[model samples]
Target: MGERVLIALGGNAMTAADGSASPDDQRRAVEGAMRHVTALITAGHQVTLTHGNGPQVGNLLLKNQIAADVVPPVPLDWCGAQTQATIGALVLNALEGRAAVVVTRTLVDPGDPAFQDPVKPIGRYFTEEQAGHFEKLGQTWRRFDRGWRRVVASPEPLEILDAPAVEALVAAGFTVVAAGGGGVPVARDDAGRLVGVEAVIDKDLAAAMLARAVNATVLVIATDVPQAVVGFGTADARPIGSITAAELRVLQAAGHFAGGSMGPKVEAVLRFVEQGGDRAVITSLEDIGAAVNGAAGTVVHR
Candidate 1:
């Protein structure tokens, strides 16, 4: 039987690690992902897609810096909106005009703690001296295994404004792509109008919000791993299959997942299932079909 599935494509889905992240490269990557998506559609399922634009948005920030003297840099929210359209175009191209993309805006709390303390790492890595250079310009930097890098706020997604449009598209049997880069983080002013913020929202968290808003039964978080694993990169690393939400939370609290990556995926899935979702699966794009059937990936249930 067909089902409604909301798919969250990880950052790696749009760009290859080895290949140059050119427009051509992105189109090729999207085409391959679309093949997997089309497979689900052909089997009579309704699909909606959301993607992370970390790398692409970072590239835009870099370009803005390079041409700042000649052109005013774009705001973070605007950069996010621009990437949504650009990535959407690439996805639409891959879909061969069969899908529709909605440029969405997400609401966040104006007093969200994330804004008070930005912790989302972004852009390319930098050496200590380079970090110092950025620090002089009032940019926040943090040390990592590679080097220092800029960090920004990853606010919680309160609502996805265009979610109805996405759901309507899926209802009409068309695949819809929305919530690119967390839907250009925004908040309501005292006057109750939408105002763009200068920060990036976590894509996984935003995906969960979209899933909830659209009332999707299954939330599929597609990434580079076929299944969520514990002791990742260690000799005793183990794959997680089906697990209850409570068990997953215990595992997460034990420090089993890294904050920047897998941690958010686990958090997203937990939020979905806890909030009445039937199930949420985390797996690689190639294993999507199997994941939906409970034959692959790590499934989190109520």
Candidate 2:
């Protein structure tokens, strides 16, 4: 039997060098990602796929805002859920019998500290005038380049609502994609009914929760970069190949990773290792197989 692996794909899995958001562009990107996934399947690994949707979700939000006059714009959470289903469906179709996507949801605590500070960014970039208009409407906005965008809170995932379903699908010999865009950021009410919230969940954190729930032996995170680097872009920069969970924690405490970038990836791997995962790999989509086989990328262990 193949080892069960959960692969968390980053934004570059969909975005290209030109930063186009068209369907053709994204499909091309996924073709490259699928090659890596197919290689893993051929190498005898039962894979469960998860992906970040920062670029896609931002495009969705922008479209929603532009069409709001003709159609009621969906809330952020609902838009997120819709993107999960959209991207997942396309990926499943592309897999052509290799994998199936489960439009999954994850549960969050209603009182997570993140709710007090909405910081996860979303939507297309806007000019200063456009940002000023949104500010007048009471939307939280931030500047990127000379433009601006709205941001939201990203809380920790408490549970994966569709983990059982995903496990069953894997047992039936199918690759599964779940928890896209951090599983739609929903929380349960007092009556136990699931309700969507106005927040996003970090994809890496959600991947960790899903990895734990499914008991995946390996957790591989595919990013644009091949390896995690320290001191990022200076003469002292170093590429990390392997490290213990303890060493990762110390580096994190020393602020070696940026919060909006590599920090969450390292943090998620540490959590997975600490919670009994055998190994974790951080690599780009093209190097996924090599990373798993220990020839490339950074590996983290307990």
Runs with alpha carbons beyond 4 Å of true place in candidate 1: 17-19, 126-148
Give the per-residue lDDT digits (tens) of candidate 2, residues 194-237: 89888888889889889988889989988989989888878998
What would the TM-scores of all predictions be? 0.93, 0.94
Q: Locate the minimum summed-lDDT window of 10 residues in model 1.
A: 16-25
What's the distance in Å from true for residue 235, model 2?
1.4
Residue 191 deviation, candidate 2, in Å?
4.3
Whole-model Cα lDDT of every candidate shown, in order:
0.88, 0.84
Alpha-carbon deviation at 122 in model 1, angstroms: 1.4
Cα lDDT for residue 64, model 1?
Answer: 73
For 84-144, candidate 1 gives per-residue lDDT tens digits of 9999998888877468999999989989999889888888887988778666766678999
